[model samples]
Target chain A: MDEFGIIATYFAPLAGDGAFGLKDDAALLPARPGQDLVITTDTITEGVDFFAFDPSADIARKALRVNLSDLAAKGAAPAHYLLNLSLPHTITPDWLAGFAAGLAQDQQEFGISLLGGDTGATDGPLTIAVTAFGFVPQGKMVRRNGARIGDAVYVTGTIGDSGGGLAIFKREKHTLNDADRNALIARYRVPQPPVGFAEGLRAIAHASVDVSDGLIADLGHVASASGVRLVVEGERVPLSQPLRTLWGDHALSRAVAAGDDYQIAFTAPPGLEGPFTQIGRVEAGEGVGLIVDGKAVNVARPGYRHF
Target chain B: MDEFGIIATYFAPLAGDGAFGLKDDAALLPARPGQDLVITTDTITEGVDFFAFDPSADIARKALRVNLSDLAAKGAAPAHYLLNLSLPHTITPDWLAGFAAGLAQDQQEFGISLLGGDTGATDGPLTIAVTAFGFVPQGKMVRRNGARIGDAVYVTGTIGDSGGGLAIFKREKHTLNDADRNALIARYRVPQPPVGFAEGLRAIAHASVDVSDGLIADLGHVASASGVRLVVEGERVPLSQPLRTLWGDHALSRAVAAGDDYQIAFTAPPGLEGPFTQIGRVEAGEGVGLIVDGKAVNVARPGYRHF
Candidate 1:
């Protein structure tokens, strides 16, 4: 089938009312008064972002979830998304079917819909890019530069499961049980970006960032942007039960620096440690420091860097 | 350099105030009250969209112009854009400099700004995807389904120069002069999407589309969407001087079926054909037809298809 047929049959059902049934040259998204739109784009390529043989459904979900994590970090409500797919001729109809199904499930789960997109043939590995838009009250977006001195640093959800999953995927040896191994891998494949807590975060977060490039690197961004230092009590950093059980002695240290945890790390005033863990404190200094056993421990590398 | 450093050094200067200096995970765009947002995305890959050795600047310009053409067709004012770049390890700092220069040139020429985007390393060929946003009056977006019977069909600029350019790029034989060859290739490399005329078109056009997948295929889209037949007077289709000089006998027919013109095709009342060539007419029928020398001409294939 041709590009048009592929879009109409497999992808059009995922489009929302504004997409014009994917027939028009562009899509219309009504501008909401008194709201600011949050926009972010991310591209994931096969071999670099995921394995070529991975399930197409998971690949689709990963592309969307990573962008969704950005919106969640900014304290915005999910609105719409545009997808750009560069596919190899080797792609099969079954693969597209699974891909569309994955997007369909997420559209329902996130209350957002496909607005418009483009698809074309590529001679290289498959690449998928998503541009997601969200809405927040005007001037109310939680940024990365608001962390003040003495602010308490907080994080939501457990960290480092995805990193453990990546180690297993690379054939690293571990005594992780079957259930724990599968769970870790699943976390890597499909990140549950904490979209549910964005609204609540707007009122409390002094500064925020979604932990994709490891907790240390992401907090480093917060520190560098806010001109304040972040001191993490490494022992207090939350970890999943499975991660704690499998990752021997250096679990907390490694997990703190390992990336792909889509949890939100933020700073808020004292006496407002709501439902998240208070892992660190904001201080008047430069760079990030980790405290372990009441001693300042040094981290060799902070997180992933794309160059 | 890491991704953040690269963005700060090169891409950050191109970002507008809404981008927050490229430090935030997401950018904010204020919604204009009483307006609707128009969104479109296009992805171009190395070796597929352009020759691998083509100037990085031209590739970047083409990527943005193609999506800008979509917004022009929809009669919307260009506002902001997000870019997603997946670069192979082979990409050099010089290449990125040229690429960013290209985007910076067009961002100023088009009066749009970079908002927020993603850049990552890829194991495959270089890929660039851009999502552009535009604004139109709340309910006045020019659509593809509003053509009326007896309306005159018009196209902006000239067609077939890009086709001639592609032919020469493929090393095809042509007796054209050197200057003409260069001009044709330039047309193919950089499309000047008629964004300035969009506001006027919004008030006068009944239906509109950008001619990307050839005049015939794109007109077929308007016809199918509008539930009407379009008959093109092939002899009347405008051609650039270089195209006319280089293309011999089957010029009109071939140009109509060649893709990537990036010109606007719209339907308007006969009295409202202001500044564009009247190439066809909308009638009470189905599909699209071409008339040459007072005789019906059959086109075996309407346009390029990616399958």
Candidate 2:
């Protein structure tokens, strides 16, 4: 199909109210009375982000979810997204259908809709860039530079599962059952961001960042931005049971340094918490420190580097 | 440099308010009391959009201006943008610096700022996606489906210069002077979208679109959406002196069927005076028709197609 035909057949139906049926040059975003718009964009490429053998639906979901995760970290409720796809001639109608299907399902699940986007052909590998829009109460966006001294550090959900899943795909030998294997793979494919915690997070957290470039690296960002040090009790950093079984002793280090966790790592005062684990404390210093048992553990590689 | 280093060194300086020095996961866009936001996104690839030898600054500006063109066509004032860059390993710090310089220059000239973005490594060619945000008075954005029978059609600036420039690059021999050759080449590398005409366009136009995919094809879009036919006096379609000198008698046809003009085409009442030329009229029919002298003209290829 041509560009117009592909859009009409698979994407136009996914467009929402402001998109003008994807027929206009631009889309309108109506102003909300007391809300500020939150915007974030991320691009995922074939091979670098996902294998060509990966399910087309999952690839679409991953691209959208990555941006959604950013909005969630900033305490915003996602409302719409723009998807720019650079496709190769090798892409099939079935792949496009599956990709659109994934976006449709996620739109319903996340209460968001397609706004407007551009699609083009490229000789390069397929690339998908998603720019997401969301809303937070005026002046209520939780910032990474708000972490203060003496604040308690917390993180939502487990970390390192996605990294572990990636390792398995890289030919890491594992004596595991199919369920555990598939579960880890699923975590790598589709992120389960704590989007539901956005409102509550804004209400309590002094500072926030999503665990994308590993738990330690993301915390380091909060530390540098807030000008405060983060001290994590390495054992308290949560790891999935399957990941633990996969790597045993070395899982802690790998998990803390790995990327694509997509969990929220934040800081707030002590003694008030829900749906998160207290893993560390913010101090009047700089950088992040990982303490395992009674000694400081060294992290050779902090996170994923795109250079 | 790593992704963080690259962002901190090159992109952070270009960030404006609500961007948080490019440190936050997402950026904030404050709500304007009486205005609605207009959003549009477009992606340009390395080999497809420009030659590899094109100036880095021009490439950056081209990537940005394409989306800016869409906003202008919708009668909106450009405000902010999100950039997603997929860079290959071959990129250098000097190239990045030049690219950032281009963005900085346009951000000043167009009164827009970088909000936030993502940079990732790509195994393929360099790809840039820009999502621009603009504002229009509430419910006042120009639509493609608003044209009516008896409305007069108008277009701003000249058409086909960019396409003629592309032809020169593709080794189409020309006898034009050096200055003229350079002018056409400049049009291909950098677009001057009629941004200042946006407010006036909203006030007068019933339906509008930017002339990107050739005048005929883009006008065809308005015709199909508005359910009215557009009849154009072929000679009235403006062509630059440089392009006319290059293509001679064939210039008019080529101008009407070439893409990337970045000029605004709109419909309004007959005899309305403005900075645009009267080129055609809306009729009680469908599609677009071109008339040269007393005979109808045929367009073999309507516009540039991605697939």
Best by TM-score: 2
lDDT of 1 by residue, A194-219 (tens): 89999989999999999999999999
Q: What tens digits encode model 1's per-residue C-alpha lDDT throughout B193-294?
A: 898989989989999999999999999999999999999998889988888778778788879988888899999998665668999899999999999999
Local accuracy of candidate 2 as per-residue lDDT tens digits, A1-307: 7888888999999999899999999999999989999999888888877778899999999999988899989999999999999998999999999999999999999999999898999888999999999999999999999999989999999999888888989989568778878888898998889889899998999899989898999999999999999999998988889989888999999999988988999999987769899999999999999999979988987999887
DockQ of 2: 0.89
| Per-residue lDDT over B1-307 for candidate 2, one digit per residue giving the tens place of the 0 to 100 score | 8999999999999999889999999999999988999999888888888877899999999999999999999999999999999988998999999999999999999999999999998878889999999999999999999999999999999999999889999889667799999999999999989999999999999999998899999999999999999999998888899999999999999888889988999999999988899999999999999999968888886988899
Where does model 1 exceed 4 Å of error?
none
In model 1, what lDDT does residue A115 have? 89
Considering only chain B, report the TM-score of each candidate against the true chain B: 0.97, 0.98
Mind listing the fnat for each candidate?
Answer: 0.89, 0.92
Error of 1 at A171 (Å): 0.4
Docking class of 1: high
